[model samples]
Target chain A: MKPVATIEGRAIPLGLKNLDTDVIIPAHWLKTITRDGLGKGAFETLRAEPGNILDDPEYAGAPILIAGDNFGCGSSREHAAWALADLGIAAVIAPSFSDIFSGNAFKNGILTVALPQEAVDRLLEVARDHPVTVDLDSQTVTTPFQDRFAFAIDPFRKHCLSEGLDEIGLTLASSAAIGAFERMEGRPWLVPSASPANVGLNGTIA
Target chain B: MASRPRTLYEKIWDAHVVERREDGTCLLYIDRHLVHEVTSPQAFEGLRVAGRRVRRPELTLAVPDHNVPTTARLGADGTPLPIADPESAAQLAALTRNTAEFGIPYIPATAPAQGIVHVVGPEQGFSLPGATVVCGDSHTAAHGGIGALAFGIGTSEVEHVLATQTLLLAGSKTMEVRVEGDLGPGITAKDLILHIIGRIGTAGGTGHVIEYRGRVFEEMSVEGRLTVCNMSIEGGARAGLIAPDETVFAWLEGRPMAPAGEAWDAALAWWRTLATDPGARFDKSVVIDAAEVEPTVTWGTSPEDVAGIGGHVPDPDSFADPAKQAAAAKSLAYMGLAPGTPLSDIPVENVFIGSCTNSRIEDLRAAAAVLDGRTKAPGVKWAIAVPGSGLVKRQAEAEGLDRIFTAAGFEWREPGCSACLAMNPDKVPAGERCASTSNRNFVGRQGPGARTHLMSPAMAAAAAVTGRLTDVRALMAS
Candidate 1:
């Protein structure tokens, strides 16, 4: 995951509030053990209707999405975030998001920008036609018509997004402390015990 | 005290900080990571791709729940687990394989410890006071009843925790929701939570860790408390918790996972100190009178779209908030309900008496008390009672709760998250209405176009016998 500073592209304006993870990716498609090829099932139910923006040729490969309040409301499934990423959505501008969904998106390198409802209303309108720009460095979303809407993300999330640090990378950054703790055996579970990998049922190394 | 006293959430959070970032974020340690079949496959795949092993395999537990059918038949050894649904079979198989490869402990379908992740976790005492717990399923908040700061995580976070045994999380604001007064008879924790969510609206607890306080929660059983905390997510809260108390400690005592003997004494001493300090500040506070909360039910899609059983369905146009008004209108349309209909008039074709929210032994006992000598209405196409886990199933059968339900014409089945969602064959068919104890009444939550009315187990049992959303409070009065 590389640092993402700005996403400038056609934005799919799905301004539907309370858009749950079930709608993002239904339960039926969750059977597959892999995260690949999920965008096809993303918004499956909503995409069944004619004239949905997800299938609209003009928004194909769009890198931005404008959503309404309470986006990603149901389920702790990361598949919702994966589907959005697979659809080439690099940034989501919404008034609010479910906390679990927000964390998932951050880990997967998708920028989630929280803006005021009025700002989102404007972005939803601007997203209908003109290209939009979300600049993480400035924490502002701009429209082709010069509409500049400032946004906010947790400063830590901003750092993680800009630094391309997932949880593992972040944890490994503190390897010295981890090593010290392991040496101290402060936590029993963290102790490195012999799991005896590649051993045989005959109770001896083969 | 020059400094402000911290809430229980802050106490637990500060205790778990492995590293604090310059950007107001921190790497908080997770004590336990619970995983389920539906949401963990991709995370395990991520670990395999990276050649990573679970950081602390002993601290992680995996189980299959969401996709297991309640009607599954016991099969001979070497035969499949009698799960005819291919999607479900695949998910369970994936979980089994992932746990095996990662050296993580798993409770398979036939295992005595197997059940819904939330129920089995607390039942096994893996959820303890003053610890941070995370699971891939949203109902993981149920673990909070045992006094842990618990919440659900996405698969990415699951992978993160699996690889590192920790998560980088931003701090959450604290909100204290203190309910005073004794609840009326038959007014369970479900009613109290529904009343609170109805008053606060769905997003009321957003960006906050809500601590359940006051007398109402203090008097609740662990199961009752879990039923309430389980739906904290539905009310848009990231996490919900109760301070560890004597009752919680007693429940955890002698369980398979709790500290023992001298260790238990030390743990209990530490847990007692985890309660909110006197004069602790909260970002927000709410007071609910237990007397006002009746047998509550959802008349629309959202859990917050609730009303007392004796109340009428609200007209969407009457809402002051435009967003709520729009959502209500849509909910009403999708639920095939109309404004001003007496909630009790809504007929139910199916009755589901399970889910992580209300599938504990007490919930079964409550429903059984209601259906003790009754039979299902002729109009009830089906009524089912699915316990929370295999252990729960065994316990219920031992107590004859299964017999009571079966005699009342309800199907008593194996443990799983049966009919909570449409992942398995248990579903409320299209265009049919169901009275469910499960959390969430979102459109098509049970199945495609299936209407769900969230209620208590007793209310669902009442619906099974009456074929309508009858008021359990009224039945008690009669």
Candidate 2:
């Protein structure tokens, strides 16, 4: 994970609603054992269109994306976030986001800013000509035209994003607490023995 | 002092809290972790790179499904054959090695237990009442049908759970979808969920855990409940839960991974209490009349772009919202649907009756019943029925459901996520329309340039026999 603070650049104005993970990166591109080189496949379908903004030279390598409501609405594919990162997008401005996609984006250090549709519409307009700025420290998206929009993000996620903290490392530090909870619950059935004997010949219970 | 009345979600969240931060996020404990080939390989690599061991290997189960072929996986000598696609084969192999390296129990691709991660979780009883289940795939919500708090996660979260057996998360707001009245005859859970999605658009359930309450859900079979919950993600809900009752307990009894004897009794006692309290409140509530739901199908790419089977294709200009109008126009163009054309008149070249959403034994039987004594229409070039799991396959075969489908001109195939996302070889050709039982109808979800119309298994079977989007009820009447 990389620390994300402030990003300033031209924004790709893909103001299409309900842009799902399939449009971000198709399932055919998911066969890779690794996460690198997904940029080539990012927006593979949409970019196929001759005039698609994702392929526009003006918005190439844009650090921000202005999208419509319900962005990343389907599939819990983290590849969507990875593909955006690969395409050099650091922040996405949408009216709303799918819960799973928002979480996945935060984990990958990509900032998701939820603004009103009005604000998103304005950004989509200004982004076509000028560079936009997103500052995590200020929790705002601003345009050179003196347009500023404030957003709210979970404080814990904010902390992780600014610090680029390893979430697994943070959770591991609370090992004692997790162990205690398990002991207190005392539900052995929750973690049944996975010995080979328990697995029947047909993979059912013996 | 009186205790606060808590909903089932609140109770589950409270019980699983390992520690809470001042910012309101908690280190939530995970009980079961299901892993499949596509989304898990990188997570395992991350663990290996960090020198991390699985905190509780016994609590995790791995299987390969997304990229596995529905065709035969063995040769005449009875040894497993190589996967046709190298990338897919490598992905599955990575899972096999990673699970073994981490001491996690993995059902081999050729094993009888191998299937979609969501289906295998409940079928093997790895998902149980009041347990917190996490999987790398979004359809993991299907396990919530059995009373587990389950949702999908990305690779990073998958690694987090594998290494720590806990997640850093905040509590989700609760939403109650209460359906009253008896569902009309011939209406299935799939239709009910599609209707719900239509009423409350795709993003309706965002940031909330929806609890399906009312007689409609309580009386639905466990398999049916799973079908409903499986598409919660399609509605933008991370998970959808149905309160467990005697139905779930009876369905879970004697399963391979379920508790036995005294443990079962202890589990049952706890499970019975895992329901919303009488005075509990929800952040949001939607009351629906079961009679209002009709056998529905999605006319556009989005799940919410749905109507009753008797309706016509909607004109985008009719949409009041400009954004929606644009979306509708795009969907219409991609789906090649003309406004004012009756939905029933839409022709389908292919029919697929399997996915994590609708590939269980019950779903297979429903489709088989519709296909019995009926053959595929001449225009329906291809039709296949892929069972959810090997167990489901064997069960269907024993009941002669496989024969019914094969005799009806639909190929009876092995279990895997065949044609669901077209990750395997069973892809609908580009520019072809398919009546599919899969959850999503997103553009190119079936294959590049492939158009999908989402429906129930019986409806898909009807489309196969008629070579068009025919209502299952009408077919049943005939």
What does chain B score (TM) in every candidate?
0.98, 0.99
Task: Evaluate model 2 with DockQ and give the value.
Answer: 0.58
Model 1 CAPRI quality: acceptable
Per-prediction interface RMSD in Å: 6.5, 2.4
List the candidate 2 regions with Cα displacement exceeding 4 Å. Answer: A185-197, A200-205
Give stretches of model 1 more than 4 Å off: A179-206, B1-3, B76-82
- What docking grade does candidate 2 earn? medium
lDDT string, candidate 1, B261-309, tens digits: 6667767778888889999999999888888998999998878888999
Candidate 2 has which clashing residue pairs, if any?
Answer: none
Query: What would the TM-scores of all predictions be?
Result: 0.95, 0.98
Give the clash count for model 1. Answer: 1
